[model samples]
Target: MAYLFLFGAIVAEVIGAISTRFSEGFTRVLPTVVAVVGVVGAYFLLSRALRAGMGIGVAYAIWAALGVCAVALVGVLFLGESLTGVQAAGVALVIGGVACLELGGQH
Candidate 1:
């Protein structure tokens, strides 16, 4: 389904971004390889999702917003990165915007 494909794209992008942090500026071979592969797969799935009838604006917005949220969470939890109140508020706003976009567009 188109939704599934879009979800896959978001997941892949989040994973790729998280792996990139582990790649140590691409000095680490394995994580770097994973990041590259994950990025390629993310784009592939995103293209498929677009082909499956989702509007480009909605698909891209959803993918980018969710990917950012996921990556931020991963950074805080797995990578021990600090998240300040301002960043948390920004993330909440992105989530709210995504929800509003979906709700307003749904017929």
Candidate 2:
């Protein structure tokens, strides 16, 4: 269930990021609200995951990695953002780093 909570945090962060794009610099109402609420929820669940025995470094790395990847995809698919080769490589490197972090500390 620690993993579950981490997943929830990741999802909430992704949704919050996407909603932030739609928020138009906080000039909009609905998306802005979603962004704020979603982010708060993300932090809450992330704390729970940590309490459930997830290492802070590992959990934060995973949360940031997944949330960023998801947000980039959402931007490409829905927000018409550019995803160049450079961005792709950057994402790959981030995932690779996550792998290293996960594996390097394994007993």
Candidate 3:
């Protein structure tokens, strides 16, 4: 399904982003390789989703929003990063905006 492909893309994108953090400016070999592979896979899956009839606006919005939120959470939980209250609110706003986009797309 298109949704499934989109989900895979989002997950791959998140993994790529997190691995980028571990790549240490690409000085680390394994993480850098993983980051590159994951990103490439993400694009591949995203294309599949689009080819499967997912609208680009909706798919890209969901992918970007969810990937950002997931990466932020991973950073806080596993990477010793801190999120401020304002940042948390911003995340909520992003989710809300995506929800609105999805709702608006259902003509």
Candidate 4:
């Protein structure tokens, strides 16, 4: 299903992004490779999902928004990155907008 693929893409992207913390600015070879491979695989799955019938604008919006949210949480928890209230609000807005686009596209 398109939704499944979209979720897969989100997961892969999140993994890749969080892995960057371990990659140590690309000085670590294995982690760097994992990040690159994970991200590429995510995109590949995303493209396949799009071809399966999802609209480009909707699919991309969902991917981008979800990726941002997931990556931000990982950064906050694992990487000790701080987010302001404004940044959190912005991410919530992005998620809401993505949901709206998906629902609208269904009709």
Best by TM-score: 3
Per-residue lDDT tens digits for candidate 1, residues 1-107, read 88999999998998789889889999999999889988999999999999999888889999999999999998899888999999999999999999999898988
Off by over 4 Å in 4: none
Model 2 C-alpha lDDT versus the unseen true structure? 0.94
lDDT of 4: 0.89
| Top candidate, metric lDDT | 3
**Which structure is stronger by lDDT: 2 or 3?**
3
- What is the C-alpha lDDT profile of model 3 across 1-107, one tens digit per residue? 99999999999999999999889999999999999999999999999999999999999999999999999999999989999999999999999999999999897
What TM-score would every model get versus the actual structure? 0.94, 0.96, 0.97, 0.91
Pairwise lDDT winner, candidates 3 and 4: 3
Order the candidates by lDDT, highest first — what do you get?
Answer: 3, 2, 1, 4
Error of 1 at 65 (Å): 0.4
RMSD of each: 0.9, 0.8, 0.7, 1.2
Residue 14 of model 3 has an lDDT of: 93
Ranking by TM-score: 3, 2, 1, 4
Q: Rate the local accuracy (lDDT) of all candidates.
A: 0.92, 0.94, 0.96, 0.89
Runs with alpha carbons beyond 4 Å of true place in candidate 1: none
Ten-residue segment with the worst summed lDDT in candidate 3? 13-22
How does model 3 score by TM-score?
Answer: 0.97
Ten contiguous residues with the weakest lDDT in model 1: 13-22
